[model samples]
Target: MSKQLDESEIQRLAAYDIAHVVHPQFHRADHDGAVIYESGSGAVLRDVRGNEYIDGLSSLWNVAVGHGRRELADAAAEQMAQLAFSNGYTGYANLPSIRLTERLLGIVYPNMSGVFYANSGSEANDFAIKAARYFWYTSGQPAKTKIISRGEAYHGSTMAATAITGMAPFHKGFGPEPPDFIQVPTCYPYRCQWCAAKPGCTLECADAIERAIVEAGADTVAAVIAEPVHGAGGVIPPDPGYWPRLRQICDRHDVLLIADEVITGFGRTGRWFALEHWDVQPDILTIAKAVTSAYVPLSAFIASERVHRAILEAPADAKFMIGCTNSAHPTACAVALRNLQILEDEGLVERARVMGDRLNAGLARLRESPHVGDVRGLGLMAAVEVVQDVATRAPFPPSAGIGPKLARAMRDRGVVTRVKGESILFAPPLVVTEEQADRMVDVTGDAIDAVTKGQA
Candidate 1:
């Protein structure tokens, strides 16, 4: 069942578009014609003009439960009618938020005890860093304000969050970023800088963290923040033994390890969290996206019992304080809780494991494709890099913008994807059946071939 938006509604949606109210992640001057997506159901979205497209990127790496699930809508409506907005500030408690905390922590890969709610992933990670710093500060580690992150990683966009991001593009204009943040090499095995002959390669990428901690003076480093499996920095999966070694390094240095699971949490990986893949536990965790399957804006940061005890030690006046007006909107929390239920009830986690294997198999067949320099991913998340030369692994000339062109071609063939740098990213909803996933790969491969002219 779909609700088709007529022409009049489309015009109405476009009328008040001064760009701020409509365009996002794009320059206002470049605001193109708005495609009003009217409604969606399992795996498909219908636009204002009635064109349908399969959600290839899961609506920005969320939407794990797909679209138009009646149960989600009903759950949101029920909670809204009962109680919609109440402050999460100063001992105020709400039903959906409370219930969701139980449900979320129930699945916490590391048995996190306390949770803090926020409206988006950026805010969650930003606040997580704050809490980490504050935890050490209150414990007499005043010098422990610096946070260490990885190169090419994206934690958030807020100042503290941006400071933690590993990508250079985000920091081009924002110089003199917070001094506490430092970056080591990201575990991008495909384009690994540490991948070379036996002379100097010993998976030193993980060893780089120990070097970073030592260089920063372990006494001053508060935490090490990283995505379990890097996203937005090019869906890079860690090499074997990477996470466990990182954990051991963090333990040796006494720095808290924060897993920014905003993108890989909630079954984006075959497991609930990518860290689970290595049986590693983190001191702090942050997640958004598929938490509510994009039905609502919700994000959370969870702290281990050890970190929670830091907050408990504070006096009443010294209680750690951080919140927003929409911190745990009941409707959103209700939807998130139900989203988890749908995942569990449907056994989609196991399904993701099986279908993810199928996705890789399809990509495995395309390894010889001229345009595909590398096909890499785990579970439902993966990427195919477009390169101009296989030997040097040089990306296509940025002037050609081949990635965007290929994406447009894929959309024309009824798939929507995104490009991070020169990498073509594919992260479909976990609900995507094997056939739908194959279409995802097929459409992407077809689009690449069409646009690149068999040129690698």
Candidate 2:
């Protein structure tokens, strides 16, 4: 067991964090009261104060094999002792990276021919954008430069990825929006403006992408990027027909489809990859987060055979001019190989499917509450949307601060997860037990009742 921090030490560290750490999505008020996590094992985390809480969001939806895995540590140490680092530049190569590439290609879409490594999802996505443009530039269609993304999408925080992200808040204070990035309507079934009143889905959301492609001129659009199941913006799973239609539209326009699977990849959504749920494939796929279970920083953008061939055939000068310093860090690759082995050997992908059903079933009972407007998810990923009025699906005003209130309430009850706007997202580790899954829903229900009891 690891040594525990004393009370004074904890307070000192918290103060240091407030003074130094520049957190992501930082808010000064929230940072002041931040809980200092010290250790985690399986689906539970222990704070410096030693209070345990269910890791409902898998620490930002990454730790798929769960926390405190000695196997991964051993793998990393073994690789580092053998060969810590290697230049993955053009001429040099490493064994672990090459082996991982082979393993990933075998499991990912059959069309994928190669992988380019990066350190984070943002970098992987930026590379995807660049690769898409490069493909068209070399194919005698230099004008194909624009990238279309859907509203409510969260690609990453990099400048190029930020422009591709459709959420308005991400663009605030970031100067004028970057050019050549277009936004279209999202396929959010609950809040879909196009078909909310209709008897059923008109799939007008998919048609909107087609409209955007035409409006931009097909020759100017290089690709259409999207998440298989939208995370962060909300746990909004696209309608069954949505992805297939989007794939058809991209093909019709000769636009490369880039699936940002940073959150949905590696068995988070039942299957090995969420796109497999729809039988649709993307030309370029950007993945991170669960790749190494966040053991170390690693990510990659994969290219389909068609896209790889185009870059390969390009002249030496135009030869996909992009590379990262840690392109294929051998240590990270070894850890990832071991992580993939654990995922496969333990059958966590199918386990996510099983536990996801249990989780959804538990959350389904929350529909009885007046504030619970929607419960939707795929596999182990789910969300409970709180509403001001159930009949109209009206959201609470921002000033009401319902999301933070509910988040605090759940945290106090030993259940911690993401509460974005009116959506309460739940994506526990695949190793979660039925009991832990039940606690997530039960605590959420109790929190909703406690927070919204007398509200009109």
Candidate 3:
């Protein structure tokens, strides 16, 4: 049961938040006046006003096992009572973290042998970038330091991670990015740049990475980074041939491949890891978000045996040092361990596949909608791209704020979702039931109709 707050208490908290809390990636004015979401269970959240909403985006793409799992809470409690915190610095290790690492290795790709802990997906990627560069520098290839990412990629928000991030809006207000963080075209079949010159997608987007490496001199490129499915970049999954081609290109150039599995790992995409969809093996796989199901902030940087061996063989003085205070936090690891157990024990990964098929089929049926330009996604992570002219694929003006309007309509209809530019994306909890999915789809379609009636 959730604690019910009086109206005055809710108002007081809202006032305090407006005065002190600086929300990330949110409109301050709107957030200041927003409803206070107090608690959640299953796939539903309840605001202070007691209005219930479907956890449509899975609380920012986390919460895979859904809300309010007592087992996870108990796991955290036990770890906290035994040993709350431990420094994971050199020469220091905790039993929970060690066990967590062993368990993770048992589940990750066959070649991945080691894991580095961090507090969030951003830190994991930051560590990965440093590790990749350090691996080359110590191997006597100091010039191989550049990392090739793709446009529209969402790596992280840290300075180094932001530089590698392909979104322009995230870079705004920040000064010039660091050098050697280059970006190539992404595998977006709906809007492929190569399709203009060629009739169809030649997987030229995948070829672009090789072109970027060669153009920059492959000796100067350390690795190529990408998400198996571009999550925040509007849930854009790559072409079927993209990942294999990327592996081949990286092999040809001797550049490492980094899969930012922050959003797609841990069964969000039906598979334990999205790379399994294409049998592509990345040298380093960065994972977070659902690792602990957001019960606690935790992320893991899983490195392949090949990369681990090189790092291990480096000169003793050449240490690849990068970490956070909460890195390998014992409680976080314990929570994550239990979370993974729940995910596997309950067969949630397979659930994601079944529910995802249902969700996509529902969204695909909405193609009859005048404003729906594209419907694309894999597993439970999906999106419905809104447009002003579907025939021309002309996007609605950002000034119109159609996405937000549609989201508001859904909210009023008892659903929560994310609005990214012209796309309304969905990544509901893996435990979401068929009835809940039906409600989500029904509300979404009605919301689109109600909001875009005249415009469409």
Clashes of each: 2, 0, 0
Q: TM-score winner between 2 and 3, please give it.
A: 2
Which pairs in model 2 have colliding backbones? none
Candidate 1 structure quality by residue, lDDT tens digits, 1-456: 125556676676676674448443555654456555778787787776778888888879998989889998899888888886887787688888889998888898655898988888999999999889988988888799889899989887888888888877888877888776788887777677777433333668889899999999999999999998888888888876888999999999989999999998988889988898999989999998899998889998999988888887876766787778988888898999899999999988887888888987897777688767888889988888888886678888888978777777788888887888768788888888777888988887888888888342
Model 1 spans > 4 angstroms off:
1-22, 28-30, 196-201, 454-456
Query: Candidate 2's error at 362, in angstroms?
Result: 0.7
User: Which pairs clash in the backbone of model 1?
Assistant: 152-166, 388-456
Ordered by TM-score, highest first, the candidates read 2, 3, 1
Q: Per-prediction RMSD in angstroms?
A: 2.5, 1.4, 1.7
- Work out the TM-score per prediction: 0.94, 0.98, 0.97
Tell me the TM-score of model 1. Answer: 0.94
- Encode model 2's per-residue lDDT on 324-372: one tens digit a residue: 8998899899999999999999999999999999999999999999999
> Compared with the true structure, what per-residue lDDT tens digits does model 3 show for residues 1-456?
236678788888889987788887767766756767888999998988888999999988999999989999999999999997978888899998999998899888999987999988888998998889887888889999999998989988999889888889999989878898898879888878787345566888988889999999999999999999998888998878889999999999999999999999999999999999999889999999999999999997889998887777877787766768888999999999999999999999999999999999998999999989899989999999889999888888888889778878888899998887878889999999999999988988898888888432
